[model samples]
Target: MNTVTRPRILVVGAGFAGVECVRRLERKLSPDEADVTLVTPFAYQLYLPLLPQVASGVLTPQSIAVSLRRSKKYRTRIIPGGAIGVDLKSKVCVIRTITDEIINEPYDYIVLAPGSITRTFDIPGLTEHAFGMKTLAEAAYIRDHVISQLDLADASQDPAERAARLQFVVVGGGYAGTETAACLQKLTHAAVKRYPRIDPSLIKWHLIDIAPKLMPELGDKLGHSAQEILRRRGIDVSLGVSIEKAGPEEVTFTDGRVIPTRTLIWTAGVVASPLIATLGAETVRGRLAVTAEMTLPGQDGVFALGDSAAVPDKAKDDDSAICPPTAQHAMRQGKVVADNVIATLRGQALKPYVHKDLGLVVDLGGTDAVSKPLGIELRGLPAQFAARGYHWAALRTNVAKVRVATNWTLNAIAGDDFVRTGFQARKPAKLKDFEYTDAYLTPEQVRKQVEGTRALDQ
Candidate 1:
């Protein structure tokens, strides 16, 4: 809230893109050039690629979260909240603090990097019964839930209840789904070893996806190899199938198969944050549309990036081919956006964002993994090494890197502690209601609702 003559730069969201943008700006800009403020729901940058590792108990939740204050060099004022509304015409952004207090602040430059949320479908009982794996809290909840499920199954006398508790179903064939299934399966495998009364063979892990291949983004060859690895570990890989319904103790698949399962993890996909819709800007697939330079066309001093922005992939020839919303692209786009912002401020030319695909690595827990680096395909332990090392290098700070590395080493040496955190004690939250909205209404809609209620009372 400094009244310096320098322009104020307000960056929203602390995901890979926003965090990197702030980091670059702090390095490039002089102290007196501009005042940078970053608003996020959390105080850390989540290494999303390794989120499954956290759920599987392979790494502590904090291992994947880099403290924004420490890594950001204190150059940027970190506001712990999300931007609720933005008045682009007035250059004012209304942010809701963590305490649920709304504060309006005017900004000279606005960067919308508010990341995507879980893309849920209208499957029956899904919202009421299934779990979601998107944040550190969710992942931690999953770890505890899985381990507790095993414990509950062992203690239960009813055969049907035990079966339901033992069967785990994960929907989505993307990296998040596959890794969550793989890592949690490994955790269960290890935890069951400690439970002498539990039968490992009776426990079932079913990965259901509408796609024909697991990890389709990793290409067909590596995808097949990854599936084989999971199948070898006694996992049921159901491709070209989707969950038609879910219940507290059962799930029915679109393939006409019914299975008993207490744990239904939904990692299907992501859509842009509701914040993007509030922008009142043209969007592609729910993401704000941005130019090759990551700027909102005709919206001066406004920039957007990450999963929330549908930026053109200049590496591709077709103008319609927008960049895929991935952490890789987001991290790269952040630096580009920062440079472009600086360029504009200095009256210099702007550069376009462009990067070729470097292939992908899918970690399948333990020594099993599949990867394509620089178009070179790899599998098994080598792939796992590549996957972990890739994420380690991609993390924002050395402290985070060391912490993640140390956690991995400890896990290897000490083995997994299959204790449940009991965080999932509450009833399953509806998928559509995951964002924790107060009135479950937008800023504009809430005012109308309040006014209508007041008139009715009068």
Candidate 2:
């Protein structure tokens, strides 16, 4: 008697792309047809757009982290590990588990969607001094750190020290930077009221960016409106400027203005995951090169998407255009890739990925927001509605939606309590502490390690 073997599918990452791909595969494929496995460090899908709100105390981390086990309908095996390297020739992925154990996972079909890391330049003292807004831990840490600053400043009698502690600087003019500045400024503004000894004027927030304009995608009028709102709220908006150097107590700008501060939030940009480079495949700007169908050319049974893949944009006539790394594109590409994977498995023709732009939404905290949903520009309350509405709709689970909506309602009515959680006192949460970019193995190292492991197994 002959037995049939199920095809093994491995998906890396738990972000917008990987999660969506797993969900689609679980729904479309039968248990006997394919055995699906997901490799990620965390078990939840992080709704990254709401991370600023988490830092601002408008929403809790759990509210945005959709659990992988929430639905019992799917039977995908979850591996609590991050893929550090992949040996394309051997069809083996090297993963570092949460327990620090290195294991090689073999797959018949693989999906690479490990997402991105915060892009940093070779600026002096930047990594050691600055904080990032990329992860859930970072958001929670920032909240506690901000409140700790207020607590320390209130206790200090020295004028210069208090002023330095109160001063905050945010670098980057993109969506993450803009929203982080707006939300955190609101947090500090409201938090200052609790400290009777501290003067509100001493608390200063400076937002600087190398770009000439803020959120250039928001169009001229809407972008200007956003800038006006931030400026009116007392945030010092500096355009075409960036940090020249950073230190423990002060940051010097490129224009030679030095400001003393304990807090420096770096939200400049993100590059594709380091795991992409370990494949030794062709890449476009650090992202793996993939066809319009989301498949790796010349590599059978492999697909890549999300922030880690430079998927060709078929919506444009120019072959040079690739899909921008955004949650919208990631989510849509996941479904397309899953469908294509299934098509390949069943010996059916695969379809190319094509989608129209859905516009963008930037929530400026409080009632101010800017959005251009479906090409219609809006600002203020209407834009706020659209922004929040879009995010609310984007939540993958009903439980997440309820929690977020409830958080919004409670935050509006009860307001932030401005309590310090003592996270900084336990351990420092600097840029170096969060992202483990140094953990990745080089392509040669990966091949050597895999070969050694295979020899041992044999």
- Candidate 2 lDDT, tens digit per residue, 1-458? 99888999999999999999999999999888999999999999999999999999999889999999989896999889899999999999999999999999999999999999999999999999999999999999999988989999999989999999999999999999999999999999999998999999999999999999999988899899999999999999999999999999999999999999999999999999999999999999889999999999999999999999999999899889999889999999999999999999999999999998899999998899999999999998999999999999999999999999999999999998787676656787888888899989999999998999999999
What lDDT score belongs to each candidate, Candidate 1 first? 0.85, 0.94
Per candidate, the number of residue pairs that clash is: 0, 0
Query: Any runs in candidate 1 off by more than 4 Å, and if so which?
Result: 1-4, 424-433, 437-458
TM-score of 2: 0.99
TM-score of each: 0.93, 0.99
- Worst lDDT 10-window in candidate 1: 432-441
lDDT (0-100) at residue 110 of candidate 2? 99
